[model samples]
Target: MTVNLLYSITGLLIFFMGICGLMFHRSLVRQTLALNIAGAGIFLFLVAQAYKSDTVPPDPVPHGLVLTGIVIGASATALMLFLIGVHQSVSKSSNDEGERGS
Candidate 1:
């Protein structure tokens, strides 16, 4: 098969794997990592589709979109991690308070 086709297939596989991981895993960290992987797959697919052929220049729009997506993904990941940390701390403190009260 063609290189583009191979890239598309690989991206699909990665995306599916991410979806499965997100659905099956219990850990917040694992789910976050899976979300990142899915984002990467989408990026790859977009870039691969942007190429028309070897002679023609690839579309600039997809590249720009990918850059924007990367920035958004990074920000989202940071937010998720921060939220997870806050949740853990809150739960820990609540548990400690309960123990002291007993």
Candidate 2:
């Protein structure tokens, strides 16, 4: 099989794994990780599609887009983690107050 096809297939498999993880897991952290995994798979697939062959030069536009997407994905993941931390803290505080009242 061609390297590009192999990469595309691998990317799709990874994306499928991520989707399964997201569906099966209940924890927000796990879901966030799954989302990131899915994003990575898309990036890989795009990279694979960007290539033409050894003779012809690869497309630069897709590469640039992938790079930009990676940055956005990282920022989004960080934001999600931060929100999770905030939620956990809020719930913990509320639970502690409830226990004290009881």
The positional error of residue 29 in candidate 1, measured at the CA in angstroms, is: 0.5
Task: Give the clashing residue pairs of candidate 2, or none.
Answer: none
Q: Would you give me the overall lDDT of model 2?
A: 0.96
Per-candidate RMSD vs. true structure?
Answer: 0.9, 0.9
Question: What is the lDDT for 2 in model 1?
Answer: 84
Q: CA shift at 84, candidate 2, in angstroms?
A: 0.8
Q: What tens digits encode model 1's per-residue C-alpha lDDT throughout 1-99?
A: 789888988888898989999999999999999999999998888898888899999999999999999999999999999999999999999999999
**Candidate 2 residue-wise lDDT, 5-92, digit = tens:** 9999999999999999999999999999999999899999999999999999999999999999999999999999999999999999
Question: Model 2 segments beyond 4 Å from truth?
Answer: none
TM-score of each: 0.95, 0.94
C-alpha lDDT of residue 75 in model 2: 99
